[model samples]
Target: MAITHFTSSNSFQGYHITQQFDFCSGFGQFIDEDGNPASFSMAKERAMQQMLRAVPTEANAIIGFRVEHSIGSYVHSDYNNCILTNLITCVLVSGTPVRMEKDMEQKMEKVLLVMDYPPALPIRPYLVTLIPGQNESTLVQLRFFSYTSEPISALQADIVLRTVFGEDIVLPDIGFARIRAQDGEHQTGFFRVNLSDSLFSAQSASVRIKKYVCGSALREGDVHNQRIDMRLEDLFDLKRLYGNDAVAPHVVYEGGWQCLCGAQNPTDEKTCPYCQRGGESRQVAHASLLRQAEELHSACEILACLQAYEAEHKGSLPLTFMEGLEKMASTERMFGNMKKECMKFLHEHLEAEEAAAPADVPDLSEEDQAAMGSDAEIPILTPNPTGDGDTAAPETEEDRFTIKSPFDDPYWK
Candidate 1:
């Protein structure tokens, strides 16, 4: 049979004066004293007044006050378990002043709500640079990659990253997901920042790199770790410094003479937009390097497919969809293999970034370098393809249990 448990706090029945104590309105009376119950009422008011005086001016009420009166050794047939428990009654109430007790109770409830909700994430230290632009105000794009299984909802993401990195800085609210620059078929999202902000005065007028990971679900007990290596370069247009409405027109060399791309109506003129080298190679060299990296990684798959196509057509490429599908089967196998390999490569790459990152970048102060010897001791970061290092799910808590913070998001810290 399942065992049933009961505590002294539970209700009981019976009558016994094993220990008689009465604190009825407030002048307490023990078995040794025979004080009038009416006289206790005046004492209660006096005690409440003394408590109000101790309360701070701003405090509406003092909470967690409990008074217990017990009459022990009472036995009756109603006491089912032969446990002659004490006849103890506890009267619990807050110590709010008579003048403002009700309003204070309401305020106390509001404080409880705030405590229930998690705190806002602290903005990480970062540098912002304005790439001159006046594009669509809507569709703010923020692209980042993480190795975490627990995905952060759009509601959890902070639209702004504010910090006191160089000077106390606040960045302008720019919309997400607007095209900035294009190279052949490649394009990236534009980031608009204000140049007038004083926070970036001491630092480069350019956006510097600052990396951080998010997700509160990562802190559950006995969790495996997941390293999130986000490639922001893939999402942001690094080369497009000038916007459509740049005050200072871009100047570039064309035919050995410098020219601008967007000046005047170049589209209507069918001429070089601003300045062109006309055959001077419009594509940036860095774009070629990035493309090469992607191509090199996908080379095995692409080559395998191309070879299969040649074999089926006897040296000629397939034109029909059915013929193409047959040739593409070999390529898909190679593609799957390449995808697995690429993830392994990416994991190694992120580990390198983590190792290279400075171990101690102190909060605000620059000179107290001595405080950082231990903090600067860099930990060994190795590639983790499994990503089970820190991605454990959180346990389910009851609805009545109030959590001050959920999901250990670095922002909350």
Candidate 2:
């Protein structure tokens, strides 16, 4: 009889069973990165466990199975953040709970789903550039590499800038979901947004993607976020004295442009006090060297050593950093002559160790082995090679209660 035609007087119990699980909830309202309900598998497992207990004690499995799960959203107050939507997973199943033959086995092929989310974001942020805006504002754009078609939502970042003179400005909560100058195939997801109300007098900016959030996932930007903060070629030493051929030159700054190196120099000393190079010559060479350093380090990535070193130290570069960079410049000259001698010693030591390799096995005496019970004979049971699960072993001359091989178990063939 159909389930719809069933009556309360004639209840169906042994033929089938249904289990309903309590609602399960996870952290986020939307599906996870793999596009799966976060707690579906968990709830389904719980329902299956409950059904197994409610079925007849003699039943081995539920054959005609039907498992169901769904997602739902509801607004609720969360202690961690503002009011947010809660995603829930509910599961239920109905099946014919029956006891199968002891030797039963299904040969049908089944497919299981596996998913991987190698990267949290579909696009990798490559570069962020800022320029003058149309209405006395700042226009910022973020260039990114898009390898997947998945859409990223609620993408926001925090950018810092330097205004004219020496004032700093921060543009937090900036949106970069707008597609501009983007080619998903050849180029990337170039995102742009006009800061309608920005620092109009900002001359040059120092931009880095220090913080960003994608969807509901909180992630920190990589150190390479400053791919092009402020190009060295565009830098200007702008406090010119008189525009004559040589009537005073270079920016007349109070602290000077040696990354604030010469702090001991007089307040009026625009440049280093001990430098011999002319003002114009040193400024131009320093700017050129910066560009060359950036270009060279892009390929070798040697500059990352200092950046990582600084982070490891948890503050500015150590005193050893400046002293070591200057002293280690000629380390090749100091170590060049010792290479041959060091290699020869290393080779000889390696060969000696190889020639005198130690044996791995133990070398215990025969009498010691016998005393330790190593020579005792151990009885082993042989598995029945060719027989159905119902086949019984012939009566053995040994004890009747002797342990049997795992293959002889009633559940096995």
Candidate 3:
């Protein structure tokens, strides 16, 4: 996990010359237990193996490598059900490529693995409010943990809810716990229980955790139990324990200047002079096209276009805005100005929507609000053009335009 004798000093001439390079590869299908296409975690070990190969054979070590991964999903109709399958996983790795001194010794130390018991209860409770009506409902989220020293093969639990009025609601067989043994981490699962209006009116509720099974045996025989009183005031204080900061940013599209046929037209030009697609229809078409463009371009292509632009313009934008846009369009299939405009449009749209909503409707918590305002945007997914369930490598033309030697490039030197 640690690298010794590796310094990031740009003036270190004694060491081998270093240049940055991009490496991309694909691995694994995104299939769930039920054969549905779902996003799944790519094992760390498998990802590491792919990254190791990214370093050239001539290089002694890889330093300051950063990785970005994305899963592409493809949907198709099958037997009246829409089936989603993992199209491909794109792994993009970038780092300072270098050769180490022959005499320098490198060593890796052994580390001990530690295992511990999982938490018995949720770190905190989450409250969700249903619509205000006769069949009004409320969701109470619960987190369960494992009792065994070893990682549990599977776990299941039943929860019994008793109201102050002596009414009992039993929920059985609630958890799916199949954590890996080598992971050495206890299983933590979340289960949500829906309570009707009558249940929510109860003065107090008791939760009994029963039939606690782990790894083929009952770990706890009705031992874990908790009781909580439902408050009328707290009903209005719905809060999400986890924030949406991790969610991808929404990408917006703006249309006016660029034409459908890739022609550079002024904003005043309401219609694309070449394609004849213009006005409101053109704007909608342009947004869809931009999303398609975003999907077609890979990270490598964007990085290449960015590097090429910087190299030619002395770290400044091109003399003609459209010229720089053209370069980006060639690689990324979209221009920087377009993306910026799209972001601005998205912001205004969200603000307008929020302003128009009725005040009585409860707003998301502060954390959730902040996450929505964050600058980060999610990666746009596009249909795979290859149709082979593999991400195509960056075109050779991109590689040809890049600086080949570190000594010649000011950034690398």
Candidate 4:
């Protein structure tokens, strides 16, 4: 008799056992060499014991056992027609055997978020009050509003005063405030601004409010940063109070596309130097949404970028920013450009969504509306290289396909 056992990759050991017995008569008890009774049950017990002894002592337990039995009969001429019988049995056991003490060492690793979601809040300089005191300084009041539904436990901002004439003034650090979600619309606080008459007379001035909101319950760590620029004249009735003829300067808020590394790049830049992300209007709009979702930064900036893109693209909005990123990643053009942090943040926060329909409703003339209903080719006008009002016809297929070498050009010659 022969027995074999196969061990799994995780198994500590393998065991095999085989036993054989000979009998002259069928269905009769026989005596062993020690005069003990020999039976199939006894032979099975001996096979099991041998298999158990062969197993390593460090093995936890045995599992997945199989047993096989075979019987043969042969005629012996010397036995005068008596038939001799031989019986063989085999048992096999296979399983993954593991030590309980070593199980902790084989544990799988876990991934964790490096940065927490930023809090949402809007802050601005709301009012200015003249304090009755020996000093001529005025009290500047700032209002804070909760951007999200949750109550804002704490908030702060870095205030910088800049004059329209390009003079930068350093301001005191603003303190924190506890603001309720419902009461945020009416909340206001004061900061003292000491301004000399000469400083006030010089052109218009603006306040740059760099607001920071504490993280919500799901996120923890540093405050979320957002920049807001407001004109001092708009916040207060300076003409009525100060009799200063300073007009408010045209306020151009800093807004642009966000890079993969979360850096804000100018709209004119074609590529981001930090992460090498595309700086086109579509790419910038998508990156801005990612910054808003991940870092809770650039909400207003992102809205501006999206609005500009929509206005430029015939009132058509791109796909949902996250969905657009996914579609772009599926193509070879944008493959591997997305960072792991950005992908992880998107996976944990954003839900699958369909593209939004364009919101703009254009007013078209009767002839234009009729053209839309027909399959007639529309005339597209191209701009001339010169600043003149001459309109050039759209390029034909031949014009587009035709290429000229640099040497053939008049300028090159």
Q: Which candidate gets the maximum lDDT versus the true structure? A: 2
> Which pairs of residues clash in candidate 2, taking residues 3 or more apart in a chain or in different chains?
none
Q: Which stretches in model 3 have alpha-carbon errors above 4 Å?
A: 1-141, 145-147, 162-167, 172-195, 202-205, 213-220, 223-413
**What is candidate 3's CA lDDT for residue 138?**
30
Worst 10 residues of 3 by lDDT: 238-247
Per-residue lDDT of model 2, residues 337-402, tens digit only: 333333233234333443464422334488868765755432232322221211222335652334
| CA lDDT scores, all candidates in order | 0.28, 0.37, 0.36, 0.35
Task: Evaluate candidate 1 by giving its C-alpha RMSD to the native, one decimal.
Answer: 22.5
Superposed model 2: Cα runs more than 4 Å off: 1-140, 145-154, 180-198, 208-231, 234-413
Sort by TM-score, top down from the best:
4, 1, 2, 3
Evaluated at residue 9, the lDDT of candidate 2 is: 28
- Model 4, 1-413: lDDT tens digits are 12233233323233222221221111222223333334445655655565655555554443344444343333234447655443333323223322332222221111111111122323322222222212554443333323333444433444444444677554545443423223223222334456554333223223333444434443322345433222332312221221111112111136655432334557676564433435443333433444344433333333444456556765344356534544534542445444444444343333222123232233559987786676643222121222121112233686433322212323223
Query: Over the full model, what C-alpha lDDT does candidate 2 score relative to the true structure?
Result: 0.37
In candidate 3, position 66 carries an lDDT of: 55
> Candidate 3: deviation at residue 331, Å?
70
Candidate 4 Cα errors over 4 Å, as ranges = 1-134, 144-149, 176-187, 198-413
The local distance difference test score of model 4 is: 0.35
TM-score of each model, paired residue for residue:
0.22, 0.21, 0.19, 0.23
CA deviation > 4 Å runs, candidate 1: 1-62, 72-290, 295-299, 302-413
